[model samples]
Target: MAGPTTQEPVKTQQKCVAIFALLCCFAVLVVLIFSSVDIWGDNEDGITEENCSKNCRIVLVENIPDGLYLSMDGRRHLPLSVGFHELLDQAKHSVEVVSPVWDLNSWDVETMPSTAKQGQLLFQRLLSLKSHGVKLKIASSLNNSAELKTLAANSAEVHFVNMTALTKGGLHSSFWVVDRKHIYIGSADMDWRSLSKRKELGVMAYNCSCLALDLHRVFSFYWQLHERDYIPSIWSKRVTALYGKHAALELQLNATQATAYVSTSPDLFCPKDRTRDVDAIYQVIQSARTFIFISVTDYLPLVNRSFRGTTVTRYWSPIDEMIREAVVLKGVKVRLLISFWKKTHPLTFNFVTSLKSLCMQLHNCSLEVRFFSHREQKDDIQYGLNHNKYMVTDNTFYIGNHDWVGSEFAVNAGVGLVVRMTNSVKDKGMTILEHLKAVFERDWRSRYAKNL
Candidate 1:
C-alpha cells in the first residue's frame, strides 16, 4: 500500500503550492498595473496603453486617511508633521502654492521649537529646495513675509496677489499643487497656527490628475494676473485649455475608490454651466442617504439680490432647508459643530438660534447643533479657532473655504474639494468618512464643545 502511488500525492501537493505562488504573483502584478495607470489620457492624445504610463505616471491616495495633527499640550498625534512638507519634498520640477497668508515668523511663537529657529528651519528648507533647481513659485499675500522672502530672494519667485482687488474679497484659498500632479487643499493657512494650533481639515489628492488640473486652472485664475489686480483680456483661454474636456467625477485605484469634484466659487473661471462651491454643498447635503455632519466657524447663507441695479443682501438658508429636509423628510441625523469665538459674527448666532428652535419641533436625532470654543483660562495660550470648514454626508465629504453660504461663494475667492466614498465607505482603513467621523466625534466630545 505504501508503494501504491505515494509519489502521486506529493506531486499533487507541489502543484497546489505552485498555483498559490502564481496567484500571489498575479495579484501583485495587477496592483502595480493599476497604480501605474491611475491617470488617464484623452484617447486622441495619442497615448497608447504601452506609453500612457510613461508620460503621465502618477500615484493614488496611499496615506492613512488622517489629517495634519493639532496639539495644544505639544503632544503631537499621528502625522507629527504637516504632510504638505512631504509633498514639497517629492516635487521634482515645480511647486506652486497659493495661500492667502504666508508667515514663517508665525512659527516663532512658544511651545514646540524656538519660534525663530523653527522659522529659520522652514525658510532654510524652502531655500534649499529652490537651490536644488526646483522652480518654487509662491502666490501669497506675502505683504508681511519679509523674512521668508529674504531667504528665497534669489531662488523662489514670490508674487503678491491683492485678492480684494481681483475679487470682491481677499484670496481665501490655502492650497498647493506639486508638479501639477497632486493637490493639498484645506482650512489651514500657511502660517504656523494652522500647522499645530488650529482645528484644520484638508485632503491630499495623490495622483489625482483630473482634480489637480481643475485646481491648477483655479490657481491660474490668480496666477496669470501676477503682480497685477486686473483680469487679462484673453483670460478665457487659461480656463478653456484645462477644463475643456468632460472630466470624470469619480476615480479609482486598486480596491480604493473615491469620487471628487474640484470646485471654486464667485464663478469667474469658466462658462455659466460650471459647478460652484455653494451648489456643490447643496448637492452634498441633498444627496445624504443617512446623516450629515458639519464643522465650520460660520453658517450664514445670504444671497445678494439686485433690484434695478442696486444690490441688497437677503438671508438665504438653503443649507438650513437641506437639514430640515434631511431630518423631517428622510429621517437623516444632522449634527453641526459651529465655532463660537469672539470674532463670530453676531448675526450667525441668530441664525443658529432659529435652527435650534426648529430642531425643538423635531425628534429622533433629527437635528443637533453643538458650539465649540477655545477655553480661555487665566493664561492657557490661546488655542487657534475651530477654523475647519467641511461637511460629511453618509457617502460623501466636502471641504473648502465656503461657509455654507451664498455670500462667501459670491464674493470671496475660495475652493471646495468633494470626495465621494460610496458603499465601501465603511472599509475602516482609508475610508474618508471613518477618518472624518473620528475627528468630528473628538471635537464634539471635547471640553470646549457645548450642545446649545
Candidate 2:
C-alpha cells in the first residue's frame, strides 16, 4: 500500500512536465503568428491596390560618376558642352524641382565653370519656371529658419515645418518627383555641399504608379500639416485602420505587387499605444535571403554595451537583435556601408566597436560590414557624412531617411517609399541590384583598394 501511494506522486510529476511542454509550444506558436504578420498595422496600405497594374519599372543607378558635376563655386554655371546641357535641360524641364533654397541672387553667372558650377543656373531656371506658372513647392526644416525666412521674404512661397516637432527627429529626406511619373530619392540635399562634399546615393524610377501615389499622399499629408501649422495627433492613420481586421488587412495586403510599410514615431503623434517601425525592419531582415545591403548614416544606437552602470541592461537592444537575426538564423549575406566621422556621440563609438565585434563573430557566418569615408581633396569633405538610408534585399528595395537604431521607445522619424519589383515587370530588381553592387564596389575600392 505504501509503494502505491509513492507511485501516484511520481505520475503527478510526469503530468506536470507534459503540461509545461505543451505550454511552451503554445507560446512559440503565438510568437510565430505575431512575427509572421505585420503586427503593428504599418503594412495596411500595402495590399489596398491588389488589382492595380504593375506598370512601373524601377531603374537602379549604383553610384553617380565622380565627374558628373552639377555645379561649381556657388554659382549658376551651366555646361558649355552639348551633351551636358541636354541632360541638364531634360532634368530641369521634366523634373519638378523642390528644395529648401533657390536663391537666384546668389548666382555668379560670369564664371564659365564646368557642369559642376551650375547650381545657380539650375536655381535660376527653376525660379523662372515659377514665374511662368509651373507648379513648384519648397518645404524646409525649421533648422534652416534664417534661410527659410529669407526665401519667404523673396516671394519663394516657402513652408517651414519643424520635423522634430512632427516626428521627434530631424528632416533628412531629399527627393523630387518628375512629371508625377518618376521619383528621385537620395542623400543629396539641394545645396552646394550635397553636390560635391557629401558621399551620397540616389535612385530614380520611371512609371511607378503605386509609389508615385503613395509619395503624393505622404507629401500632401505633410503639406496639409505644414499649412495649418498644426501637427496631427497621429502622423499615420493607415496603420490604425488595418490592424486586427482580417478583411481590411487582406484587402490591403493583396492590392499591389509591392508592399508598403510605414515607419513613424509615437512622440510626435499622440496615440493610446505607440507603434515603432523597427519591428517592420526586423521582419525585413528575417525575410532577406540572397543579400542584405544597408546604406546608413548611423548604424549604432545611442546606448552602448550590454549593461550600463547597474540598473540599465542593453542586452536586448535593437541593433543586437538585428545582428543576431540577420547573422545567426538567416544564414544570409549582410553588408553595411556606414559613414565614419569624428566628434560624433560617444555612444556611437561604442556601437561602432560593437558592430565590428559582431562582424568578427560572423566571419565564418557569411556576413561582412564595412565603414566608408568619402575621399576628397579638402579636409572638410571628410566630415560631410553619408546621410542616406536605404536597403536592398533580393529584388525588393527600401529607400528612407530614418536611421535604424536606439530602443523601441526611442523614435527617429523619416519618409520614403518601399517598392517590390519582379523580373517580368520592367527589370527593376536587376536595376537596383546592379546599382547597389556598383556603389558598394566603389566605396570598397576607395576605402581598401585605392592604390590598386
Candidate 3:
C-alpha cells in the first residue's frame, strides 16, 4: 500500500514536469516567431506598393538573404535577376523600356537557364499584362519584329526611334520605368544575352517618382520621334512636360539622401547646355578624389587607335584626352573592365595594350585593365554580352548607355543616371561603393578576366 501511494505521487510529479516543459517550449516558440516578424517591416526583396508608400527607395540585391549569385569568378554575387520580374509583376499602371536592341526572339528561341527562363516568362507576362490592358510602351529599335508588331497589335505598342534619323547615330540606352515611379537603370539590354549569360549591373530606383519621371523625360523625347498615328499630338505636350533647366533634384533612396543630376546627351528636348553623357563621365573621372572604377561593354578613349586594322586618329576623342589627364596628371588609379563579346573589334585588344604600355611608363599614376569572358560559352551560341556601361567614384555612382569612347561611343543618343551619397551614412549601413568595388574586384580577379 505504501509503495502504490508513493508510485502514484511520483507519476503525478513527472506528468506535471512534462506539462511545464511543454508550456515553456510553446511560449518560447511563440516568442521566437513573433520576434522575427515586424508589423511595419520593410521589404528588402523588392519594392511593393506598401513598401513604396513608406519611402523604400533602394532595393539592395546582395544584402538580402540568398541574394548571393555565382558570377564569373566562381564567387557568389548579388543577383541582378532577383527583383527584375518582381517589379514587372507588381506593376499596376504602365511599363516603359529603353534598350539599344529589344530583341523579342530571345524568349522563345531556346530554353535558357533559370534566370533567363525567368526573363522569358517575364516577357510573356508583359505581353499578358498588355493584353490585360496595362499600358505598355517600348522605346527600342525593332530589329526582328514581325512578331513584336503582331504581339503589340494584340495589346501593346512599339515605338522605334531611328538613331540615324534622330541623332545621326544609334540608341544604346537600357532601362525600364514601371508606373512612373520605379526605374531600372543598368547595362543589360532587352536581349537573351542580357538576361541569362551576360553579367549586367544597375540600380533599381523604387518609390522615387522624381528620378523616374526625369528619366521618363528622356524616354518621352525618343518616344516623340516614332511618328505614331495612334498618338499624333503627343510631341508638343511631351516636350512641354519634359523640358526644364533644373540641374539636379533632391532625392532620397531609403535613408541615403543625395542630389542626383539627371544628364542626357544632345540636349534636344530639354534645356540647352545640359552635360552630355560623355561629358558627365569626364567630370566624374576628373573629380575623383581617390580612385575611379570603369566597366564598359566597349572602352575606346578618344585617342589614336588602330581602327579596322589601320592606325588612325579616327578614334581621337576629347574624352580620351581627359582619361589620359586623369592618369598622367592627377594620379588617379583607373581600373578598366571591358567585355569581349560577339562582333567586338580586334583593334580593341591593341588599343587596351597601348593604354597598358602608356601606364607602365608612368610612375605618378597607375592603370589596370582586365577582360571578362564567360567560362562556358566561347564556342557555343549561348555566349552573352558583358554590356555594363557604368562607373563609380568614391561617393558617386553613374550608369550610362554610352561606351565612353568618344568616337565609337557617340554613335547614338544616350542617357546617364548620376547619383552621389550626400550624407555621411550609407543607406541601411551598406555602401553602393562597397558593393561596386567588391563586384569590380571579383571580376578583375576572376579566371574569366585577362590582363592586357
Best by TM-score: 3
Work out the TM-score per prediction. 0.74, 0.63, 0.75
TM-score-sorted candidate list, best first = 3, 1, 2
Better of 2 and 3 by lDDT: 3
Model 2 agreement with the true structure over 1-452: per-residue lDDT tens digits: 89999999899999999999999999987766664343322322233444432355444432232543322223222212221223234343233333433332324334423433444554555555445444455655554455445445545555555654554444444566544445666555565445434545666655553444444434444444553444643434432312211111111212234444333343443232222345445656666777777777776554332234453434337755686677666667777766655633456556555554654645446555566554444454343456557787775556665665563225333444444443433232334445555555555545322210
List the candidate 2 regions with Cα displacement exceeding 4 Å.
Answer: 1-54, 61-116, 143-156, 164-168, 227-230, 234-277, 303-316, 343-349, 356-364, 375-387, 405-412, 422-429, 448-452
* Residue 6 alpha-carbon offset, candidate 1, angstroms: 99
> What is the per-residue lDDT of model 1 for residues 268-297, given as tens digits with 9 covering 90 to 100?
644323567766777888788888899998
Candidate 1 segments whose C-alpha is farther than 4 A from its true place: 1-80, 107-120, 141-148, 227-229, 232-238, 241-247, 269-273, 302-313, 363-365, 376-382, 425-430
Cα displacement (angstroms), candidate 2, residue 144, comes to: 5.4
Stretches off by above 4 angstroms in model 3 are: 1-56, 60-78, 104-115, 228-246, 266-273, 302-313, 360-362, 375-385
RMSD (CA, Å), each prediction: 19.7, 14.5, 24.6
1-452 in candidate 3: lDDT tens per residue? 79998899899999999999999999987765553343212222343323333233664332111222336344344456666776676688788888776553553455544444645665676678765567888876554666567557767777777655444555667778887688887776666556666666777867776666656656766776684323222233322322222455655666766667566764443333355676667767877877888888787654344458885666555766766788778888888888776655677888777666777756777878887665345444335446677788887777876776665454456777777767777755666656676677766776767776
Q: Which ten residues in a row have the lowest lDDT in candidate 1?
A: 54-63
- What shift in Å separates residue 320 of candidate 2 from its native position after superposition? 3.8
Superposition TM-score, candidate 1 onto the true structure: 0.74
